[model samples]
Target chain A: MTNKHNPAALNTGRRPLRGAGINLFYLPAILILIVFTVWPLLSGIQLSFTNWDGYSPTKAFVGLSNYLTMFKDHNFGTVLVNTLIYGVGSTAIQQVIGLGLALLLNSRIKGRNIMRAIIYLPALVSAVIMGTMYYFVFQYQQGALNTLMVSLGLPRVVWFDKPAVSVAIIVIINSLQYVGTSMIIYLAGLQGMDHSVIEAADLDGAHGWKKFRNITLPLLMPAFSTSVVLNLIGGLKLFDVIQVLTGGGPGYSTNSVSTYIGLTYFSNQNAGYASAMGVVLFVIIAIATTLLNKGLDRLGWES
Target chain B: MTSAIRHAEAASRSTDTTGKGNGKGGRRIGHALAYLFLGAMIVAQLLPFWLALSAASKPSTDMSSTLVPRLHDIAWDNFTTAITQGGILTAVGNSVIVTVCSTVLVCICGAAAAYPLARRKTRGNKLVSAGIMSLMMVPPLSILVPLYTLMVNTGGVNTRWGIVLVTVAGNLPLAIFLYTAFIKAVPESIDEAGMIDGASRFMIFIRLILPLLKPVTATVVIMTSVGVWNEYALSNYLISDPGKQLIAPRVASFFAMQSSNLGVGAASALIAALPIVIVYLFLQRYFIAGIAAGAEK
Candidate 1:
């Protein structure tokens, strides 16, 4: 089996038709992608400029009116602000906690694997389930938190009743569920580090926070970017937990782009407006991810 | 100097130049503190799930009065009511079907699309790869409005097959990206060796490549299936039928029931998540690998 052709044999000008089987391998996925993923993306842009209610067979073009209304809608304003806060806030919490866990776990520790798995447990449940479980935890009256607080002679507070607090709560819940992912990524990065360098640092008489600041974090930038992008995008698109927990309630203050888009499209009976909002949401995510990744790349290069 | 060495140097500078015994004792204390902090956090994290589980076991009426109803207050009726009254059985069945179908198809299609793109250096394939790459970056939400309308128009709404196709389509990019990276590591000699045996490319893919893809497949399968299983927005918006919908939305209806009885609702929610959680427990190694691999791209 090995004698006939070396790996060097395949790519030498005979690569154009590596095996006429290329189409067979590519077509099924490409076809499905075109129909489901590509088509809607193309059409969605066109739909956003119109006033097409979902039920209407014909979409009368409104030429940026939908976009205009989306920008001006006070509810949209709050949703946009909430989306930013959620994305930034959740990413911040997850990063700090995740990196701390990674650094701690990387050191010699007992029950490390168990701790990692336990932290990741919350992530296994769906957002709706987490939100529901937490609904019990945050109930103003008989809620777990309130019960504990009262038992400790502290004041009991309603968690989701206030719009701003609900927004903050949404970010906290997202961070709690997802921080494990960042930890795992960072741990992988830590494990991949060249240990010889650490030994050299030890020989150089350096240790502790100085070692981490000068060495570990920079090398882990790729993992850091991955974690940030994932958390940021996830935070931006947050829906299920916020939906279940607050339903964008105390008014639309807790709504991120996802839940707002759902509400607009389904209940508001305004597909065009929803499409416009979706497009805007898409733009925000695209721009933020690009900027964040680029900024990180530059930072790594500059350092 | 490499940041690695530089940081190492900085670390060495900060350490005490004192005797080894004192350093060892100090390190022990630091290690103990790290353990203590992590232990407390782990407990804090697990407490909510534990509380929910305990609540699920309790009688509905007792849940309201007790912060975490004791196991002694257990009511087997929570499961009975959840299964019987909550329509949990049907929702679970539907979720299983959708998640399985989508995951399998995504794996297959992702493999198919990834192989050529990853291997071929030709201009045409490069262009195609670039297209898929960019498309991968686009948010599925941006296309939600049109996707919903198309699904509706094509009679895809509320259908098992419809959601399956949608889920597969939505998740393909990540799968393809992962598979491509995985495959690139497979030396072309394996394929060339197979080709010398008169095995065609399709045969090589099936007979050779498929088996080798086991690790990435686990990653893809776990990630995609869990994603589809837990999905709420797509299933809810696309499948309006209460009975036909997946567990997320179906479980969502339990919120109303939860207002009255936390036990039954918690029981139902846990039941809905039980399958994925069980899968994660068994395949935790692959689950962690998958998260890392998926993110590395």
Candidate 2:
């Protein structure tokens, strides 16, 4: 296949005269990206240095005050901690559960396809819808969960009273909803694995736990890496779930960076502070992603 | 001791003969365990949807009960009340108009924009691809202030077009990435064939390329539609007029109503989610595949 499609053969036959035509097709995408994406990002950096309330026509420069205020703000610190806990905690759970499900489904099992479809249903539902649905499930009174506990002679629990627990519930719900996506990716990776290695391990008296740990797990690192990065980025930017489930309440326990920025800008009318928070979030995400990419590259998993 | 020795000898014999019987037995157990675990997971995942559907069907008073509704009672009434009293119909209309217009425009623009990036080999292609990739990492909050300013300056505030454009801008990066990936799969031979036949680039795109993009286009359409329909932040900020809000914002407003009409609120939530859910159920396979594709490099 490589010999038949040699670049030299193509180049000898046809000089590249289609550059103008190609540029015509490419220009719009570049234009749109600059106008909408690149411009906003630069403006966000500029805004972070100003004292512009969202409604103000003219803005005064505040230098580094917004950044200093963010560091000093107690609520911002709490939200930062909350974001880390939610991101790491949810990513870990989803990775474990999703990989387990993928391995289970990859085996020769009846109804595997149907089970895959069923498990994936949640990913298709809107985050807002899921939040609304879970809200009723966790409500103090008239909630199905509380009713079930009472009927079973167990004490009723207030799911939202404790901020930490409510945030945990939000993380769990979001993680579960997205597990199917990572599971499928893992399944694809598992399917692409060479079976002869497992057979050889079996011949060497390795079975079950030994085979998985020594062979299968190491081979599935690419999928693991992909799932982790995707989940981490997603968890960092979570908004709709919190908005729907708890509305950043029982007093800001479940507020994430995304929601904090939203409220700061829209509700508090502090655009400059919000932009500072946004810039901070962007820098953190960029550093995290860069480290992850470098780590993956060192492991030679890019392919 | 004699019986144990006999059993050991029998196991050795079975192993020496390829262990087909043992393998079958072990596989059966594994299958059963897999099914059990998957069944439990599926049930847990579907519980919220079941609860939502049941609550939507029951009257507000009955919804608070522990028992599940045996049959849907307030179906038509809830829907009608949600539309009239809750003003969900207007929201739905706004959502549809915005979603449809934006989706069509994005499809056209995204495909056109992605074509060169997919086919051409140039130094700029790498930069373009990286730029699009990095765009995905930007949190919506990063641009909320500037985008809001842009909308206001352009007279887009409080208009359907404002929300629509925002949605388009937000979704375009991902759509272009997906389209480019799929477009690469279209054989260069087809393009050569079209060019040899003296077809103009425009004709080639419309006649040759567009038809071949059905699957990816379907994926993009369904994804963007669901996204636009369920969008809240942009609509919340941009559409302040009660008459101009979309489904999600309407649901929010219904929840915040001073009267506290839980029945109508629940009904509105149900209505907002039903279209996406039904579409999803029908296109589960494509939706799953599309998500997986989007996640892939």
The clash count of every prediction, one per candidate, is 8, 0
Per-residue C-alpha lDDT of model 1 across residues A125-189, encoded as one tens digit per residue? 78888888777778776678888898899998978778877887788888989889999999999
lDDT tens digits, residues B114-136, model 2? Answer: 78878885777868777887887
Question: What are the runs in model 1 whose C-alpha is more than 4 Å off?
Answer: A1-21, B1-33, B63-66
Each candidate's interface RMSD (Å, one decimal) is 3.0, 6.8
- For B1-297, candidate 1 gives per-residue lDDT tens digits of 575546555655566553434467888898788778787778767766766677787775573533566656578798889888888889999999898899989998898788887776568877777777666656656677899888878999999999999888888888988898888899988877776665667787889888999889988987898789888877878887878978988888766556778778878887887887788788888888788777787
lDDT of 2 at A156: 82
The CAPRI class of candidate 1 is medium
TM-scores, each model vs. reference: 0.92, 0.86
lDDT of candidates 1 onward, in order: 0.81, 0.77
